[model samples]
Target: MSVLEIRDLHASVQVSEDELKPILHGVDLTIRSGETHAIMGPNGSGKSTTAYAIAGHPKYKITSGSVTLDGEDVLSMSVDARARAGLFLAMQYPVEVPGVSVANFLRTAKTAIDGEAPKLRTWVKELRTSMEKLGMDPAFAERNVNEGFSGGEKKRHEIVQLELLKPKMAILDETDSGLDIDALREVSQGINRVKDAGSTGLVVITHYTRILRYVQPDFVHVFVAGRIVEEGGKELAEDLEASGYERFVNKVGA
Candidate 1:
């Protein structure tokens, strides 16, 4: 089984030319294949930073501690190397790629990760099938990636990659942001498709619990002040929905 282990992961985000703002402070967590973990926290509590750090985002620097995937050092790998090594991060705000079509983008990504291109006939069929399952029109295959697409469309495209690439570990950074209920449910179903495969580890980072109801997590971690303050099962997420992060914030302050 695949394993992702984070130990005392301390990191800082580059704020300016010369300043780095400390974000993650001695964070520790672990995810095994087939397990879904939710990282919940208040705004600015370093939830996104953790995802970026694990994905080797250059903007987020790892000052100390270690992140490893199946005994290999993750922090040392380059961004592309991280992806080829089976780590995927769906950004909070996906950028628009003006020239690249969705079909070309997904095919190139799949080829890069697999170290070879897929058969043209089979890839096309699979691409259309994935989009249909996500409620996306097959014609979107010709549209530029996230260019002029709605917020829901961009998020759905991210999941399309998640399905095609089949990464060993996926960190969804705020997949539910800006999505209406209908869009959210569609995206969650796409995610559940991967979860059902039981091969990829899932780390869902968000401030809200709505998505958790659809993509129910096996472990719920309450993050505060750059570290996890409490952890429990799915019930903890329900409690957070009812009570919110105030108690966790106070516990951190205490």
Candidate 2:
């Protein structure tokens, strides 16, 4: 059964009347437990918007349709409620919280999501382990969140949160962007580690094929003009890598 379902979701960013508007139009997607789906799209496509909408960001209004988590109405939930319901989004550009320590931020997040306080000793141990798994220094937990972090460090930190929280469904929005080859491998390994723990579903939104090579998506989708135009198995990603999305673009009439 699908853990996450988006049915004909329509969303738009409210902008000036004269500006180009409406990001997602009738987008549909389903992700099940122990499955990984990759969404690839050209520039101006609504890949990130889809992820944000699933996470229930207030900025993007859902014009129509529904998003459900394990049959629960996700669209009706507040952002915090959605997080507590086991939905996570690792953003492309993570913002810095200068005053907040990584340990404090993660602990609070875990406490909120789990509806209880996590034991400090146990939580710190788990956080350190997750940090090590992502090739990050143990001392990183003591520093401010995302403050002065390099691009690779920011992505790795996001993975660290993913590991610590162990959300049932994780939406990785451009998690592979701006990382060097080693960092990319580390990030993919972290994702695989979580998947191996069972009952974890993934929706990876990306523009390039490099990360897919490591993560190995079960289903690959092509998003164009705010809609999923094509979907197939792993081979489709390889095909897109070789053919450069031209075929898919023509197929979508874009």
| lDDT winner | 1
Q: For model 2, how does the per-residue alpha-carbon lDDT over 1-254 read when each residue is reduced to its tens digit?
A: 34888999999875665543689989888898899999998987899989887887767779899999999999889899999999999999999999999999999999999889899889889999999989999999989999999999999999999988989899999999899999999999999888777778998999889999889899999998888888899999988888887776787784
What are the clashing pairs of model 2?
A: none
**How well does model 2 score by local distance difference test?**
0.90
- Candidate 1 deviant stretches above 4 angstroms: none
Q: Which is the leading candidate under TM-score? A: 1
User: How do the residues 120-239 of candidate 1 rate in per-residue lDDT, one tens digit apiece?
Assistant: 999999999999988899999999999998999999999999999999999999999999998899999999999999999999998889999899999999999999999999999999
Worst 10 residues of 1 by lDDT: 51-60
TM-score of every candidate relative to the true structure: 0.98, 0.96
Stretches of candidate 2 exceeding 4 Å from the true structure: 17-20
lDDT of 2 at 74: 95
Query: For model 1, what is the C-alpha lDDT against the true structure?
Result: 0.94
